[model samples]
Target chain A: MLKNVHFGPSVLPFLLVLPQIIVTLVFFIWPASQALYQSVLLEDAFGLKTEFVWFRNFEELLSDPLYWDSFKITIVFSFLVAFLSMSFALALAIFSDRVIKGSGAYRTLLIWPYAVAPVTAGALWVFMFNPTLGIVSYALSALGYEWNHQLNGGEAMALVVMASAWKQVAYNFLFFLAGLQSISKSLIEAAAIDGAGPMRRTIDIILPLLSPTTFFLLVINIVYAFFETFGVIHVVTAGGPAGATNILVYKVFSDGFVGLDLGGSAAQSVILMIIVISLTVVQFKYVEKRVAY
Target chain B: MIENRPLLTIFSHIMLILGVVVIAFPIWIMFVAASHPEIRMTQVPLPMLPGGQFFENLDIALNRGMSGMDGNGVGYMMLNSLAMAMMIAVGKIAISLLSAFAIVYFRFPFRMFFFWMIFVTLMLPVEVRILPTYEVVANLGMLDSYWGLSIPLIASATATFMFRQVFLTIPDEMLEAARIDGAGPMRFFWDILIPMSRTNIAALFVILFIYGWNQYLWPLLITSEPEMFTVVMGIKQMLEAAEQAPQWNVIMMTALLAMLPPVCVVIFMQSLFVKGLTETEK
Candidate 1:
């Protein structure tokens, strides 16, 4: 009977993924291969003629100051957004973990921001930071400080960072809250009985136990900062005051799609893919083993 | 002791209240600005209270300058957003449940490989091969159509992973019992798996719906015609046309309206959303 079940059940599994595999192959893998091909080909200024010019686009990108600047901006933006959001989330999770009363309401309120699409969030933030109409700008003026994202590169960069961080902190909070709930209460009690204070226990015990959650969050946050900020950046500053806020992916969008420079866009995208994939591989090799679960 | 406890509680209350204000302020500002007139929007220390321009703004937004290639109306964009979101959500749910079941229940060749493929897609950002994907769709003549919008997104690695995880939670004994009762794999899946995974399906629906609805760039690139554009793309175009000076009240009103669908889904599916997160951690 077991042998009789073999061929039929085995075939069913292939059938399950067949549609998805085909669609992905046609839409995903095929497109990616085409993009790679395009990256090596030279295109005329008007985007009509193309010639195979292997590695020329990549070399140009490597030598371009603007490309490197955008790359650096991307890295700084991703790390800052991830770090700040994670820190805030950890703090909020710890605070809300202890007090059960009204916790549901708090979680719902906190997570509401996560539900808002990033574009809407960016638009809302842009409005709020408007010099004349935005409450933030009005308050800043009242407090005797100037703030205008349109003109100041630093201010524009800060606004983009803040907008990205705001949407993400809630997601980080969700994971941290989940992690906190899973931690054995007895561990905390044992530490307390051993005369360990909350801070000490949290540092030595809680942090180690929650490392898996933190690591997962780190990956998610980094990917989000790299891939997901297109909407936020587009709406908030459009890579503002001299392209200071222009991250890598946004650059790809501008060059490939807006400027119709397919080769340059593909080259930039290849670099982005390499950076992300290498980081991910490193995480899997080194960090995955340490994940407690 | 009572004095100290009250003070601590008061402090906590203050902090919580501050959190509420910080979270709600922007949303409040959107509403407040939407209700005020254009000239009033220029007033410094912008109005603390909502005014009477809300209806007027809505009238302009819903009715004005919609004469482009795409019928310029909020309703068309709403329909596009709803249809695309629903199509993706339903399609993803169907594919995920089936694929997950096949992987979990039956012994199969390359099971681990297929599983890894799904997980690996999660690791990839969409931008990695977006250009080529665009080429494929364009070549297939799917551009400027809803099929172009829905198909590529319908098969989500995240949803597949989620469903596989969910299916693993079900006991083997249940499947064995169904088999003993002469229920075939298809029948068992339809009756048992669907009902059991209802909550998960609902959760996936909300997430995928929100994702599809919020998609801007892909749709913007693929569909150049205005009538076929999603609300998000419409909003971007609106911002682009605003150029030097934007009408804040109209912009705020439109944004607030655009936000309603996702907000409604989140509020309506609160229980499932919380449960979905809690279960994923497990």
Candidate 2:
């Protein structure tokens, strides 16, 4: 009777959300399943042309040098972009936390880049880095060093990473700043009164308290690296300088969409899902308990 | 609140000023470059100061080849972007709020399962399933349609998750009071829950608006008709069709124009933006 009583009211609410359930099922789950299924099959333009190939595609991907290169590139790029962006963001957040004036203006100006479309951001950055007419290129020349991303693999990857990171720093800073603001002033005052140095106060009080924000940012940054950077890379590098910057998503995009190899692309997508899920699980297992509320 | 620490304050200001410069310099550079003509754009020493042709470039940039080629015009693509952004934002927000309210305040069998289902969607980005998604929409006969672009995005798990979190923060007593006053679940949500969540809704609107505005890959894949291309697509079209080097001034101008909507939204909803970020932790 008690179970029925609770269930009665809940039924209406569930029905209220019927549209979302149907939509998600029809749109998200169905498509995802289709992709997963296709990963193991050989599909032609008309439809699935071959029977389930089981692990053949996976084996092929593993054996392929280009696949490994892309996989390695993805890992290195994610870490470099995530770590450097967060560090710069933390510095900016700490600085903004101290502002008593014009902080609003500073914040509005800084977050403007995040609002720019990724394609537009790519276009703008490429314009600035244009070897001949680019102000940035000229500046580098004046400083007695040539900067050409088109020719160098390492430089190309680094330039894409830096551009992607710059787009995200404002977003990370926003969250970190909010975390800083939420920490009680009294805690900082107490730490100061106890003769804690600025560094000591930060390490002891602020860092522990900011763990939740950091964890959230960490998850988000990983997701952004996996999903968002493809557009920028497509524009700036086109996975160029001999496909040196061909990260996983870009590879999937090029292979699946551009190259018209749907089955291979689907295989790559499955691999990507596994990587993202495992990485997410690993992160939470290691750090979830440490995140202080 | 710390007192008589002018030296510390000075040090902090120095750090802040430098931080601001690093953050804002690229945007300032883009704006400065947009102001210059094409020849000046490629000059050995690029102009550090804003130039006079800003409006002229903006004029040519907004009116040229229907796709913003030939150093002129970006109007049609901008409209496509604004329309698509509106459809995605409003549709996603409305459906998410309804779904979130249902899951939060309603009691039912399999409630936890339904909630988990939505939560799981947060992990499956559309990009991973782009090919299959295209198939589903294609089967629905939605290719290149507004419905195609908007519907796939409207059932967003992230927004539902956010709304659920925000609704969970509302005091249950208020909801109980509404129930006792003969209000139905929908009425209670409309009168009490909705009002309490206005600020949250505003912030989510801004975030989703920006997301829709920035869409590139989906728009490119879904639409082949040149008339249907969004601003980002138009920019790509322009980049490819440029003669020798991309007309930097025109490209920068178009980029700036594409950026204005979210910039305006963020400035107006600035308070809600911070509030939404802080409230997520709560």
Candidate 3:
């Protein structure tokens, strides 16, 4: 990755890299290693007693139905988030790309949500859907439908998914718009001359050409829903209504910090690390393939 | 664009307007909520329009803060968030620039080792390892401090990689010319390289500033004291307190203030933000 003509090796380079190296070691590597080590040891809540029990935490986690439920919830949550956000973004991006005039204005109106934090988005949505005071809930009630996310697991899941997906649409839209822009206009023009309608051209040409962007956004959105939506869950549902919205990341937090199950939390952390590593590997591989193309 | 179909153009515009409205609806609701009085907010049909109480609520939320909480006003929390975001963005950009320069310029021992070490940080987000990291920070005596809030989160692999990519694109002749002119490494880095990559640095600063400002769980874990609470995290505290006293006006006002800066940055620095986002992800 270095340049062909590089400076000579010296002590300065070490000093230059030292700050990054120190932070990575102290914050990232050390704590990660501690998680691995703690996974193999079972300790009491007070840290007074400890027993080296290799793989027991993992065994218990694998066998625990609640952990499995959380796992399933995470899978459902991420998939729904990725699907909802990506589809909405793709549609918006397509329309934004199509319009010849005021496209920039539309984009400006759309992309600011990228800067809004997940928690803030959560607060906004939760406020709008508050059971007693929320206008949306009032509307739903007017339509003869009950709306109480605090008491309904399904509603809780839906609320969180909407909030998480809402924040992510801006990011997916940018990438999709970029992808749409990169396609040669001559191809579309030729198809139009060949009597292809707009819908037919989009299905046969645009979507296929934008598959790479779609795939990339899919992975990124899943990872985001997995890790970054913690604030949304924390603010909106807090994994409430019988743990319906409690994803794996929140579970690790509750199990470790609230339940005082250190070994179990460490095990969950190790599992999450594996998931992130695999997703990163897949992303890098696809990126390399894209570069090769 | 291939053919000017008037009806299709009209349809596209309609769909876009609808999409924009759907996206902006919650924000509109937040503003309306923020503008109304507390009693008006608690009513079944929350006010759909902005009320006269906007400045009055703003004054309360910004200065007096919410009651029954830690009493740190939104103004103070916004200052803390600004400091934390600035430190994180500047610190990440500074350290990453140095490390990237080193990796690209000097062939030192364990260069690949250090590179991979930084790369590993990407796979282990703070969420996964929250407990142990919290323990480490607590042990280091950095809790309830800005250094604690910013330093641990500042070791950014994406920024390092982005700078490295930018450095790779720089012409070798610049470095050769600088060397011929007897300019040392740091001098060349400061003068030539920094100037060339100014756009990239600015773009990355925008992305990292939002990232730092939006951080929730890390700040929530460490900053227990009210004075150290960030505005984004303070919104959560306000939400928790809303269950008891239900000060929806002040709480919504605080939420509005919390999201305003980053939103403004993204809107104003739209190009740089887009550049930073695309380049860093790549």
A27-138: candidate 3 lDDT, tens digit per residue: 9999999999999999987899999998999999999999999999999999999999999999999999999899999999999999998999999999989998889999
Q: Any runs in candidate 3 off by more than 4 Å, and if so which?
A: none
Q: After superposition, how far is residue A130 of candidate 2 from its true place, in Å?
A: 0.9
The residue-by-residue lDDT of candidate 1 on A1-293, one tens digit each, is 01123224447778887766666667665666677788899989976789999999999999999999998898899999999889888877776776647878877787777767778788888878876557898889889988899999888888888888888877898889888888998888888889777678879988999888898788778888998889989988888789989998888888877787889888887777787777677666644475547
Measured by lDDT, the strongest candidate is 3
Over B145-215, each residue of candidate 2 has an lDDT whose tens digit, in order, gives 77877788778777887788777777667766776798877788789888998988888788778889888
The candidate 3 chain B region of ten consecutive residues with least summed lDDT is B64-73
Ranking according to lDDT, highest score first: 3, 2, 1
lDDT of 1 by residue, B1-282 (tens): 111245545555566556657767788988998898877877777887899988888876666632232335566777888888888888878877777777777777787777776655554466776677787888899998889988887656767767877777777777777888988888888999899989888876777777778887778778987778887766666667655666777777778777888877777787776665444433
> Interface RMSD in Å per candidate, to 1 decimal?
4.1, 3.6, 0.8
- Supply the DockQ value of model 3: 0.88
Stronger candidate by lDDT (2 vs 3): 3
Best-performing candidate as measured by DockQ: 3
**Please, what's the RMSD in Å of model 3?**
0.9
State which candidate, 1 or 2, has the greater TM-score: 2
**Best-to-worst ranking by DockQ:** 3, 2, 1
Higher-TM-score candidate of 2 and 3: 3
Q: Better model by TM-score, 1 or 3?
A: 3
At residue A120, what lDDT does model 2 achieve? 76
